[model samples]
Target: MKRCFTALIALTGAALPSASGQGHSALVQLQAHHSQADLEHMEEHAHYRYVGELLFYSSSFLVEEGGVERAATEQEVLGIDLHAHDGLRMVDQRIAVHDPLIDKHIILLSRNEFGALVLERLSPLDRDAFLANKRATMEQPSSKTQ
Candidate 1:
């Protein structure tokens, strides 16, 4: 079963379009390609489903600030908590990270083949939308199987 799954992933990854086009880095292409509709398209692949769950999750990020690389503080990591049920959302290779340090600044992070996390994009989340998402998640019942 493990071998079969691995084979499936290799094949599926090969079938996806090449994102390493000229002028744009692979990460940039992936970010641009993974719109809501593109994500829906990727959802059909078994590899996407399996690998999405298997990617690494980090609690602290080493980010460059003022010409110096420093680890992000807990507050700088945004929407990150050891006890929170879910902190990050991943689709394909991109994950959304919310940092509350600057008015809910959200960044999309991508995991490279070498397992390093890279920042792809940064966008601000409106306060109202953020609150709404929080409320909706809190209202949902747990889907735990056991």
Candidate 2:
């Protein structure tokens, strides 16, 4: 009986992190790797034209409509909200290039899991700006006339 009790206690200790839902370090590491890859891709494509900080949070809410007697409809919605949360930081760097291809840039930073941080690429211009830029570029006269 003593040996069985001791073994149970040992097993419980080994499983405590999972049971308590605190094992997020692995997810954090994966996010870090993703951030690195994004940075590298941005550099290779000459897209380093802007640098900024960002903070984001994601949450899931159970939305219930109507009363329980009338067949309450409940659904879980995942929402991502950006905020200027405290203690959030980003390290932005641009690659060494004489002439960057892009003129404007935006960076998105967010957290994964509890404390993991990630960086994503974003375009600074709105839809109209993007369309105008595309049109202007396309309308430019080339050296060889059509």
Name the best candidate (by TM-score). Answer: 1
Report the number of backbone clashes for model 1. Answer: 1
Root mean square deviation (Cα) for candidate 2: 21.4
Error of 2 at 2 (Å): 61
Alpha carbon lDDT of each predicted model:
0.32, 0.25
Flag clash pairs in model 2.
Answer: none
List model 1 lDDT by residue over 66-130, tens digit each: 45554333333332331231345344353334444333333344334212321111012222333
Give each model a TM-score.
0.23, 0.16
